[model samples]
Target chain A: MTTMMLVPGFDRVVELVPGERAVAIRNIPATLPVFATHFARFPVLPGVLLLESMADLAKAALGDGHWRLRTVRGVRFRHFVGPGDQVEIRVEVTGRTDQTAQVRATARVEERVVATARGLALVAAEQPWEGTQ
Target chain B: MRFHLIDRIESWTPREQITARKVTSVAEDCWRPTPAGPVLSFGLALEALCQSATWLMMLSTDYRLRAALLAVDEACAPRDVVPGDVLRTHAVVESMSDEAAVLAGLVTVGGETVLEASGILCSLMDAERLDDPADTALMGRQLLGKGAPR
Candidate 1:
């Protein structure tokens, strides 16, 4: 596989300017191997990919720390991010308390909001046994 | 090809019980290395369990599976989803109608509840035209070298 094709779910780290805001983008290329089987005419990016994009954005917003989601309710899919459309996703760390942090994120198609998610991030003592496999 | 997502579900038999499982590994992008060193993303674990439950529920039906996750209520993740953790998901179909099924899923690790979710899903088309030529032909290539579940 070429280095270009190695990014399975993510395409490129488009724009990351500092402070708590970043604009990251990924494309659902029709030629992708998953598209070959994910679906036929009405192919769409899996919700899991949406979550991943959100999480990766969180990772950037939260430069260094361990945060896990306690809840992510009401994640609505207003529209589908398909092969031809470019998913311009943005995430901003809206608020932060001692133990809890709130993030506001959105997936946009140039001007319209394709999807949006309000995520909760918490800071806790790192786990003892993490990746054992 | 068999759907690995729903492979374990073989019985079409319906009861008051249903079972599913989700395993988080390195490849799933849930694990990360911290200076304090690696952590598991609990959110991913919850989503996996939800997907597993969805796979089982959809497999029980004979419609064109175009399940859309409408909502996730009462989500709680208390601990990190470590690699060894096996999320044994259990969903008792609380309610069902002609088009949708509401499932209550519980994610457990070491036989302990780590997360719980109430999810809603729906099928695309009716059973009779489930294999319509246009539909099958379009969704067929994706299932190349594979057949429908019995």
Candidate 2:
């Protein structure tokens, strides 16, 4: 996708969880210009963006900022979220190694599961994205 | 690894969101050895359109919300889009309430719609309902400093 698609001015932050999980909340305001033109009638959040929320949760859980996804499994989407609905993201590591981890994740709205995915990723022993800066 | 580029948002009137053309080159990257041939993948095409909507909305409202595709949804590829065929992607914002928004998009070639799909994005997070604090600490530090954004 073009860099143009990346969210601008939007903010993301990680929060505390019950155990070893990490949570982050992002709010998509209704006034966003994309909606004004998405269509004359039918408008919905892009599927890729929903998938990215899963990735964002995984990124938050890994702690290390730089890692590429190797595989994704058991991904299923059930519900739809719109301007007012809050996307609740939950991600935890099912297993891990120095270089990789198996993560179990879920997206929800008000106790309802919107989507779920199992992710396999290659992680670095150290913070790789940090070195770049 | 292989990367596919999506379309751009040309303009957005009050009625509809305009998507620019998306192009995928057939060159083999270091990770992907085989050329992708003349047509681009349908999944990627739909992704490009959704990406376009996210950016357009953010730019128009001057707010940043992060999320990506949640599913394949109802995407259909009726025809092949070649390397040269400019896939013009389009989507409309159905409704926006609170912080979540929905955009439905279409990919077209020569005015004929080639693919269709939908996207749903949300804009709220509850700090109390997150995963483990220890696991989220490092990412939290990088994200919202000490106190998570309330």
Candidate 3:
């Protein structure tokens, strides 16, 4: 995939309890072009990319549907993720409704908490995007 | 692709606030396939706002300090941004210190609020660590259209 496809789909799902919790892992490759421009010399995964990974994992746990991120609250970047770092992303569904779902997410590297969000709200799209069917 | 998110600086009020523009393009790498359609990633949209806020902080410090996003207290994107949409972001400094600053950002499309964020904390650092002074100065000037013709 090109550098634009930033999430770099999860390599493995350790556990997934639909409507409850999900755990997944992704290994950051040293070659991602994003590392070059994010900081030409000092390379680290962008914090936004970590949030996107959490969002993607939330979608996986929520099942087949168009889940669009609506809001994020209390997100903190505690540590930097660098090349060769394996990130484990965890998401827990805190609440849900017909129109939206609320989740809390965290990312860790080698048992050290790297990033977290207290709440992420996702809205369900009524229809799938064209050509995705 | 270069990660420069803000396309241009529309206005600036020193340390108070800054308004910037971003015109999405289909050629940009940020587009991702979604169930509804390919849409601009919300993270990128947020990044744009952060970049804009960074600019404000940088200018406020006379380019002597660089800002790094540290935390987001709250953020919301109510509308999906598609390719070709022009986004206007206004970032207001809510608080600042020698080492950090908290800013609020709002993004709109055609006068409609699409995204809003508050309590964005950015840590200020020495500018030389992230970029050369001369280059950063040039970028600031270009973004403000300092030398461009009408």
- lDDT digits (tens) for residues A57-128 of candidate 2: 565566643444434555566676666767777778777666777777787778898877655343542432
lDDT accuracy of residue B48 in candidate 2: 69
Residue B7 of model 3, lDDT score:
81
Error of 2 at B137 (Å): 49
Candidate 3: clashing pairs of residues: A128-B35, A129-B35, A129-B36, A129-B37
Please give, for residues B46-97, the per-residue lDDT of candidate 2 as tens digits. 5667656654554444333322444433444555555456667777877654
Q: What are the Cα lDDT values of the candidates?
A: 0.56, 0.51, 0.85
Model 1 / residue A112 / CA error / Å: 3.1
Residue A56, model 1: Cα distance from true site in angstroms = 1.6
Superposed Cα deviation of residue B40, candidate 1 (Å): 5.7
By summed lDDT, the worst window of 10 consecutive residues in model 3 chain B runs over B141-150
**Across residues B69-135, which tens digit of lDDT does each residue of candidate 1 receive?**
5545446666556655666666666666556666677767787777776653433334333234445
Instruction: Identify the runs in model 2 with alpha carbons over 4 angstroms from their true place.
Output: A1-19, A37-39, A120-133, B1-21, B24-46, B49-150
Q: Pick the candidate with the highest TM-score.
A: 3
**By descending TM-score, how would the candidates be arranged?**
3, 1, 2
Binned by DockQ into CAPRI classes (incorrect, acceptable, medium, high), candidate 1 is acceptable
Task: Give candidate 2's root-mean-square deviation (CA, Å).
Answer: 16.9
TM-score of each: 0.70, 0.43, 0.91
lDDT, candidate 3, at B78: 81
Model 2, first chain, TM-score of: 0.70
lDDT rank order: 3, 1, 2
lDDT tens per residue, model 1, A55-128: 66665656556555566655655676777878878878777765666777788877788777766454534545
